[model samples]
Target: MEDCGEHEGTSELKLGTTIIAVEFDGGVVMGSDSRVSAKEAVVNRVMNKLSQVHDKIYCALSGSAADAQTMAEIINYHLDVHSIEVGEDPLVHSAATLVKNMSYKYKEELSAHLIVGGWDRKAGGQVYATLNGILTRQPFAVGGSGSFYIYGYVDAEYKADMSREECQEFVINSLSLAMGRDGSSGGVAYLVTIDSETVEEKCILPAELPTFYDPDTIES
Candidate 1:
């Protein structure tokens, strides 16, 4: 479950899902698989992991569902206040820094990792990864247990000059591969694309997911 902390209660939902974000030519694309589980049982199949923290900024969550969701909410509220104080839109870096500080301060108690990405007038499009008291701005970021299976693929396939459409396809393809291989990641795929003028949200259902291989042609 992606190094999740021990649940204090049996009823707590554990989210061991895949979350990723990619910076494209004009903006950022963030996505996640919609499956929440508790121990060996699946509790929810359509949970949204992409959260809007500000106007164009969003975060993709992984690890304990409760911890991640609570953290996102707190960050959202703070960013709103910060924007009001500054009399301008908040930068994506500021939102990510808030997440990093909180995550680091509560590292002992919280088991969550997040990818913060969005568009700002100053930076255009940016992607930042935060976890284990560390924060880095990258062209792309992936998290959760499913990430272990796709590191090599992402490293090999990612391109710095990818267009918006290519980035979207890349996220969907990567999620499909992970969902096929990781038992914890499944159900529909939720994606959000943020640019200077628009925030686009889309969903890819299980039946509509792209097929990558023929089972009969594969070796177990």
Candidate 2:
């Protein structure tokens, strides 16, 4: 894969990262697995990738971890700058535009990609989102895989209406499978979800066929 930015030549990326957004009667819910790689796992197994940046604004990010962090920094700066410039944080609208511009501009160097979730107030307030994602309608995003095992398993039961737990289980397992078959992805799995008030974090161990298949086997 091409280097997105500081994460240059970084071959080991995550596999089966699935971000699912559901709009409920009150607000929206978003979820993602916590797996960074199958072969290598960093400490702090959990990351708050999803955030309730504002009362109505929530964000979830995925992609090259480093690139994702950079983009998030840029986003945080952009929001602050624009907020001071306009006195009101246009998080949702601005985030959508911000991500699009970043992705379009740094598609080659920045190791960044994203799946954003949030809500905006046009009149009554509505949840809005954008995704320049690698996966179209599939349940998961497999970045580092041989395309045989990862895709095969993810596509087998990728339900758009899956629950948060189900999605997490499927993605964590998929990462394990990819790490076993592919050289690019393996390690541990992470999960983050956000709502109107707060964000939650969960990490799981890879499901490889060895002495390491327990869900409690997390590194970070």
Candidate 3:
């Protein structure tokens, strides 16, 4: 923790999962499904699932939903505070410091697992997400039930070499693949990208199912 908030101490909780990120082309995309099931039964409570903070960035998280929500609120407040003080886009690093502190402030039992992405005005491009236990940014990150699968597919496929549209397609396809294989994940997805203007929202694309054909028509 480079700089954490004032608190007695705090720990983290892992709850519903998610996958999200910033891409090479200065855009952002986030994805998460509405599946929190066990033993074929599901949790009845509704969660925000995925959202944008500061109107300039997007986030998806896995951990204590309660904690994640509160942290998000604090982050929103901090962004406003910075905007007023600096008269410019809030620096992601400043947001990180605030989240780090807030997490510790509420660290006793309610701690969130989070990932955030945005456009860094100072850097003149979109910033990727990193996982350091705070609301800070990273180059690439994934969360949620299918996160491991989500990360695996994209990590291998994503390249600074790919075009913005190409990267977006890869992310969409990767998420669909994750939903298909992971029982705890399903439903549609939402995505985004942040640049100077911020591409902050996109519709989720469901996984592609293989087509079935008549056996007689098969070339094999």
TM-score of each: 0.92, 0.54, 0.73
The window of 10 residues in a row where model 1 has the poorest summed lDDT is: 1-10
Q: Give the per-residue lDDT digits (tens) of candidate 3, residues 1-220.
A: 0012223455332244556564565555555555544334455323445656676655565555555666777788778887989888776666656656665666675545566666666653444443333454555567765777656667787677566677567656766677666666665665665667646566643434222234478587
As a TM-score, model 2 comes out at 0.54
lDDT of 2 by residue, 1-220 (tens): 1123333467544433334344433334454444444234343344544544444555555556667767777777777787788887575656657777777777666654455555444422223443442222222343323335656666775676666566556545554555455444334544444444545556555443233245467576
Report every candidate's CA lDDT.
0.89, 0.50, 0.58
* lDDT for position 160 in model 2: 61
Sort the candidates on lDDT, descending order: 1, 3, 2
Candidate 1's residue-wise lDDT over 81-141, tens digit each? 9999999999999999999999999988887888999999999999999988788999999
Give the number of colliding residue pairs in candidate 2. Answer: 19
TM accuracy, model 1: 0.92
**In lDDT terms, which candidate is top?**
1
Name the runs in model 2 displaced over 4 angstroms: 1-66, 83-93, 118-149, 206-220
Lowest summed lDDT over 10 consecutive residues: which window, candidate 2?
133-142
